[model samples]
Target: MKLFFQNKLYILAGILGLATSCEKEFFPQPPSAKVAKETTKLEASFTATPPLSLSDAYWKTADYLNIPLTDLSKNELYSDGFLNMTGTFKGLSSFNKGEDPKVMMKAAYDKTRVYIYIEWTDSDFSPEFAASIFNGPNDPLKPDTFRRWTSQGNSDKVALAFDIANASSATGTFDVVGCAASCHQNKMQTATGSVDIWNWDLALSDPLGFARDMMTDGTKGLHDDEGDNLASQNKIIQGNSRSAPIFEWDGTQQSYKRPDGKITLLDPGFYLLNKTPYIGDLDKGDKIYHDADYGCNHCHGEFGGGVGTIGEATAFASTGFAGKYSRASIKSYSASELHPGLSYWQKVPAANQDDLIAYIKGLGSIPGYYLKDPTGSSANIWSVSNVVRGRINTGSVHTNYKVILVRDLTTGNADDVQFLSPKGKSFPFGVALMDHDGKNHIGSLKHLLTFKL
Candidate 1:
C-alpha cells in the first residue's frame, strides 16, 4: 500500500495537511527515535471547484502549517527489509548536511475532490528513478528479484496514508500510531483495518499526471487498487538467470500514443513511447562487439567507456547518468551513429546492429519503470507536480517541489478511505517526504483534517 514507510511522519495541513489536516495549533509531543509527535489540525475549507494545480486560488484562501519533522534516517524496525541507504540518498550530488529543510503543507475540498499541497527544500534535484544497469550477468534485478530495490540515482517523493476503518494492530490505534498500526514485519497491513494510499512517485506516476491510488487491508496487505495498470517495470524474463528489457523507443515522435487513446509527449531519458520489442538475434549482436576477437569494451570498457573514456563509462550508474534513460535519448536511427568517430564503427553488421542498439540504448541505463494510461478505480487521485519535465536543476540552489494532489471525497471502493461530510469532517492521517530515499523519510504525525462545516 505504501511505496516507502518512515517511522517518522509529518502532518503539514494543506489543511489537506498531510494530504488530509487538523487545526493549525500544534502541541509538541515527546520525540521518539523515529516519529516526531505533533498535534496538528487544519480546515479543508470548501471550494466551488477544487483546484488541482499549485497556482489555483485555493492556496490563497487557506493557511498552511509549518510542521516538525524527525530525521528517521534508516527506519529498520518494521521496514519489511526496505532501508534507506546512507551516503547514497542524494545519488550523485552532495547532500546538504546541515540545512534544516522547512516543511510546509495545506489543503482544500469541494463537492467531488479533496486536495493537499506540500513543499520542502532539498539540496539535490534527483529526478531519475531506478535504472536497469548492465551489471554483467549478475544484476540482482535478473528476476527471482525479491526485495532490496535501491535507486543508483533517485528522485523526490511524497505520500499520504489515511485510515479506512476503525483500525488497530501491533497493540496500537490508528489515532495513536498512525501508519504504524498497519505496517508489520514483512508487509504493510493493519491487523484489523485498511488504508487508502496516495503515492506520488516522481518518475513513475507523475508523468501520467496521477498519484497512484493504492490500498492495504488486514488480509492481502498492500496492493494497487483495481483499475487501469498505469506503470510497471520495463524488464522481461529471458528464461532464467538472465533478463532484458522488453521494449525500447522505435521512433522520435515526442507525443507517442498510448493503447488507451491518450497522447502525451514522452519525457526524454525518462519514458519510451514508440515501442519495438526485442526481435533481433542477441547472439549475433554479442559476438560482433563483446566477442574476444572484436572487443568493443577494449576501448569503451565493459559497456561503453574504457581507457581513454573512463569518465564516460556507460555501464555504471553515476550522477548525470543514473537511470537507463538519464541523459540517454533517441536520435539518428543507428547505434553506430551514436559514436561515429570510434574505431570499427562500420565493422558492426547491420543485421546485428540491434544488439548494439540494445546494448547502448538499453545498457547505458533505461527506465526502471514504464508509464501507461491508468484505468478503473486506480485513477482516483489526479496530481500535478509543478516541475519542468525532463530537466534537472544544476544551478546553485536546489528546487523545491510544489506538488498538488486531488481525489474523490468518497471513493466507493471497499478498500479506500471515505471522507463524507458531517460525521466525517475530521480525519487523522500521516504523510512523508523523501529527499532521495524510498524507505526512510522526514514526516509529521497526528494531524487531523477538519472540513469546515
Candidate 2:
C-alpha cells in the first residue's frame, strides 16, 4: 500500500508540470506585440468638409471637426482635436540639434480651395527688411552695421510636402514611413521620382502672392542647373540677373544717392533696363558716383589691374562702374556733368539711351526680387495658388497662420502627381515651421492624410 500511494503522488506532479508547460507555450506575449496593437488602434481616419467661405469664419468651424494628433514624444494625445506634433532638427548644413516647439494643425477645404490653419509659439518676428547698404570705413569689423544676405536673413516660413502619385506602391515604404522615404540624401533626384512641395515664405509671398511652388526629384538633371547653377553662370537668360541698388533722394544735393551716400548708376542688365527710371530731384550741380563698397575688384584687383572681364563687368556693374577708366570717368563726370571721354560710357548708342534712363528711374523704386520665379513652372512639377494671413500674440508668444491653397484634383502635367481618385484614397505629407527669427525650424516626421469629401 505504501508503494501504490507514492506512485499516485508522482503522477499528479507530472500532470501539473505538463499543464504549466502548455500554458507557457500557448500564451506567450512580447512587448513589441503590445506596441503594434496600440499603433493599430490609433490609426484613425479624418474627414474634410466644405466651408462657406475661405476666411476666418471658415477656420472657426474647424473647432467642430477636431481630430487628435498624438504627440509622439510624450505618448499622449491632446484633449482637443489638435494634431500636436513635435520634432527636433539636426544637420550640419542647416541646423544643430534643437527641440521643435509643439505645432497645432487643422485643415478645411472647398470645391476650389484647401485651407490649413497652424498655430505655434514664437518669441520674435523677423521680416525681410532691406539690408544696410551703408558700409562705412568701419563696416567690415563693425558687427552692428553688418547685414546678412536675404537667403541668410529671412522671415519665418512653412513648407508642406505631398506624395500625390502614391509611387510607394512598389516598395510599400512611403505608406509606412511617409515623407521620410523620399527625403534621404541623393534619394530625391529626378531619376528616383518627384514630390510636390508648397513652400510659404513670409517675406516673399505673405499677403499678396501665393506660396512658392517647388518640386523635389533627383539631384541630377537640367532642372537642377536651371534652378541652382544657371543664376551665377553669367548666362544671359531672361531672369538671370535681378538685383538693383537701393537709392534715396538727397534733398540738399537735389539728386538721388545710394544708401551709402554715393550717386546711383544705371544697371545695364536685362530686368533693370526694361523697368522705369528713377525720378528724384535732378542735380543741377555735379553727379558724384562712388565705386560699390563691395565689388569684385576689391578682392580680385590684387592679381590683375582693377579691370574685370566683360562678363564680370556686366555682373558686378552695380558694385561699381566697369571699364578701363570707368571709376575715374564716373567721378569726373559727376563733378563736371560731362563724360570723361571714357570708352565705356561713350559706347552707349543713342538707341539705348532710353533704356539707361529707364534703368536709372526704376532705382530705389523696385523692391528686391529674391525668388527665381514665384509663379512656378510646369517643368518643376509643382504649382500652387494660395492666400495667407497671420496674427501674432506677443504676450502669449504664439502666432496663428491661415493658408488657403487652391489646386486642381489633376494638374495634367507629367511632372505633377495626380490626386483625382476615390474618396478613400490616402496620401502622406509633412509640415515644417520656422520661428520669427528664422533661425530654427521643425525637422523630420511625416503625417498621414486621407481624403474624404
Candidate 3:
C-alpha cells in the first residue's frame, strides 16, 4: 500500500514469505526460562495451516495486531474481525489437509513501507476492516502515534512506520510508506499494493511523521486509484525488487509539498534510499533481512497461513502454544544458565550492539556482514537473531553472537575467551577489546572468533 503524506508519497509494500529454514546443527540449544527460574514449565502442542478460504471462520483466539485494546481481552481483540465475517467454508470440516490462510497487511509512512503476513486456519479473519483499537475509540491501531489510516469497506488503508529495521542513532525513526487491506472474507474483492513516489521533506527524528507536513492531515493517503501514484516509478520497482521500493538517502536538493500545502525538502540525514549495487536483484544477501520473513505458517501454529497486517500472528492461541517451542523461545535462551541471564551481561557489557547496528547500516546493504550464503551458512540467520536479541535486551544480555569483548580488561588484548549456551554448555570462542582496525580499544569488545561446536 502507498500513502501521500503531505504531498510527498511513502511506499509500503513488502514480500510476505517464510523465514530462512534452519538446519539441525550441533549448535547448543538453550533451556527454558521456567526450568532455570523455578517457574512452572508448561508443555504445549497444536496444529496450524492456512484457512481453506475467506470464510473458514477461525474461532480460536489469535492476536496478530500489536495494539492492546483497553476494553477487550486479548482474545476478544483478536477475534473482533472474525466476529464480523459472515461466511464459512461450506464443506470443509477442518483445515487439516495443509491448507492455510494467508493474511498480508502493508502500510507505508514517509519513505518506508511495512508489510506483515500470517497464515491460519479460519474463515472469520479479514485482511480488510480496520477498527478502532481499545486505546483509541475509532482508530484500529493505538497508542496511535506510530500509525494512521484511511478505510474503504473491508479494506482499511494504513500508513505506518515499521520501526523494526531502523539501524541508525535515530533508530526510533520509521521508513514511511502506504498500503491497503481488503476484507479477507470477501475473496471476491481484490486488494492491490501501491507506493508513494514523493521525497521526504520533513524530519526523520520523530517516529510518527508528526513533525512533517505529509501526516498533519489525512492527505498523505495515496492509492492505486490515484492516477499519478508512485507505483509507476520504474526506479522503485527496480530498486528493491522484492515487494517495495528502496528509497535513496536524501542528499540531493529535492522539494516536496507539506501537509498544509507548503513546499519543502529534507536534508541528507532525513531519508535513506536503497541504491545498493544489486538493484532489481531478489534472493540476494539482502532479501532475507526483511520483516515479511515470518509468513503465516511460520508464526501462528494450527492456524491458516497468511501474511499479517503487522506484527506476528498468534502462533499458539494460549501462552501454552509457545510452550511447545520452549527450546526455541527467547525466554528459554536468554535466561538459560549457559547463556547467562541479563544480570551477567550488565556486569560486563562486551559488544556495543548500537555500534554494530551503525556498522551494519553503514554498509548500505541488507545482510551487510554475512553477504553470501553459498554454504547455506547460518551466519545471516545468526546475525538477525543476534540483532533481534540485542534490541530486546536494549543493551543487557550478551552471547557468542552478540559478544563485544572477551579480553582481559587490564591488558586489553586478545585472549582465550569462553562462551556458554543457554544450557550451560561450554563453547570455544575468543574475544578481544579492539577498535575498527582490530586494535585494542578501551572498554569495548571488538574482536570475536568462534570454533566451538
Candidate 4:
C-alpha cells in the first residue's frame, strides 16, 4: 500500500510541473513594439542688402529699429531722412506645424547694399518661391506672382515685405520686396519715383495702434500741422533737412523765420498732412506751378540740377502768379522777394509728378507711415496649432493631420492691424498687418534692422 501511494504522489507532482511550464510559455508579454521614428526637420534661409545715404543721422543702427516716435528728438535738426532696417535669420521645424512665425530686426543703414540671412528647416525646401511685396496702393494682387510696383508716396515711403516658411524654427528662410528680381518690371524701373514708405512688416503686432495714434494722432484726434500747431509752417526753408519742423507759425499771422531770416508765403495757408495740397485742383499741364513751390525739390534737389529760366519755386508759384491783374487774389510771391533759389524751379512731366504724389499719398505722412506699436500681450498676439483626424477604410484605419487656428488677436481689427512673428520670420498662417497695425509701432524702416541677442 505504501509503495502505491508514493507512486501516485510522484505522478501528481509531474502533472503540476507541466501545467506551470505551459503558463510561462503562453502568457509572457512580447517586447513592446518599437516607436515610429520622428519626421525629418524642415529648414530655410534669407538674405537682403540695404541702401546707404549721405547724411549721418540717416546712418541707422539696430537700436532705432523699434523706437517710439516720442523718443525721437523734437528738434527738426536731428532728422534721419527716414529709418532704414536689416537682419540675419535662422529656424527649424517638423511637418510644417503651420504656426505663426516670429522674427526680429537686426540693423539699419542708408546704403543700398544691405546683407540679410534667413534659415529654416524641412525635408524638402527651397528659397526660390520665397518673395516680398510692398502693400500700398501700388502693390499688385496677392500671391502676387508678378509683384507689380507703382509710384511712391509724397513722403518717399518704401516698405519691405517678405514671404517665409518654417517661421518658428531657427533655420527658416525669407525674401524681401523692394529688392532686385522681386520688384515689378515697370515699378522697379520707376521705384525711386514711387512712395508709401510705411513698413508694416517690421513693426510688432500689438502696438500698431499706438504708433498710428502718435503719427496720425488718431487717438488724440490730432494732425501733424495746421494753423500755429506745426513746428514749421508749410514752408520748408533752405538748409533744413530734418523731418519735424523747428518752428510753428500761422502763415498770415506771423513771418516764418529761418534760424537766419523771416519770410512770407505767397499762399498763407497751413499745409495739411492728411488733406490734399492747396493747389490740388491745378491741371497737370499748367506750367504755372513748379515742384519747388511744394517743397518737394528742396530735399530731393531738382532732378538733374540743370539750369532753367524758372527755378522750381518760381515754376510752382507761377500758376498762382500768372497774369499781373489778379494780384490781390494771389500775392506777388517772387523768388526775388523771398530769396532767389529759395523758390527755384525744376521741370518734370506733370504725369510723373502726379504719379509720385499719388504714391506718397498712399504712404500717408511720416509718422503715419509705420504700423502702430504693441498694445498688450493679449491684444497684439496670435497662436496656431496642429491636429489629427482618423479615417476608416476597407477594414483598416488611417490617421490624417492638419494645422488649425489656435488663437487670433487680429479678429475685429482692420486690415492694417496684425501680430508679427517674434523675430520678423514669416508665418505660413500668420496675420498680415496694415501700415497701422503691428508689434513695434514703426514698421520696417526701409533699411533698418532691430536685432536681438
Which number leads on TM-score?
1
RMSD of 1: 14.2
Estimate the overall C-alpha local distance difference test score of candidate 3: 0.19
- Which candidate has the highest lDDT of all? 1
| Candidate 3 residue lDDT tens string, 1-453 | 234562242111111111222222322357633221211111111114322122222212222212210110011111221112111111112111212222211111111111111122222211112111111122232122321111111211111211111211211111221111211122211123212111111112111111111111122232222112111121223322222222322123334442223343322222222222212222221222121432222332222122234434432222112212211242344346664223322332223322222211222212101011111110100000011210121123222211010111111111111112212121111111111111111111111111112
lDDT winner between 3 and 4, please give it.
4
**In model 4, which regions exceed 4 Å deviation?**
1-150, 153-281, 289-306, 309-336, 341-453
Off by over 4 Å in 3: 1-223, 230-247, 267-453
Global lDDT of each candidate: 0.59, 0.35, 0.19, 0.22
lDDT by residue (tens digit), candidate 4, 283-325: 3312223344553445332321223434333322111112111
Query: After superposition, which runs of candidate 2 have C-alpha atoms over 4 Å from their true positions?
Result: 1-56, 63-101, 129-152, 166-172, 186-191, 219-398, 436-440
**Candidate 3 clash total?**
72
Error of 4 at 413 (Å): 7.8
Candidate 2 residue 291 C-alpha distance from true site, Å? 15
Sort the predicted structures by TM-score, highest score first: 1, 2, 4, 3
Candidate scoring better on lDDT of 1 and 2: 1
Question: Could you arrange the candidates by lDDT from highest to lowest?
Answer: 1, 2, 4, 3
**Of 1 and 2, the candidate ranking higher by TM-score:** 1
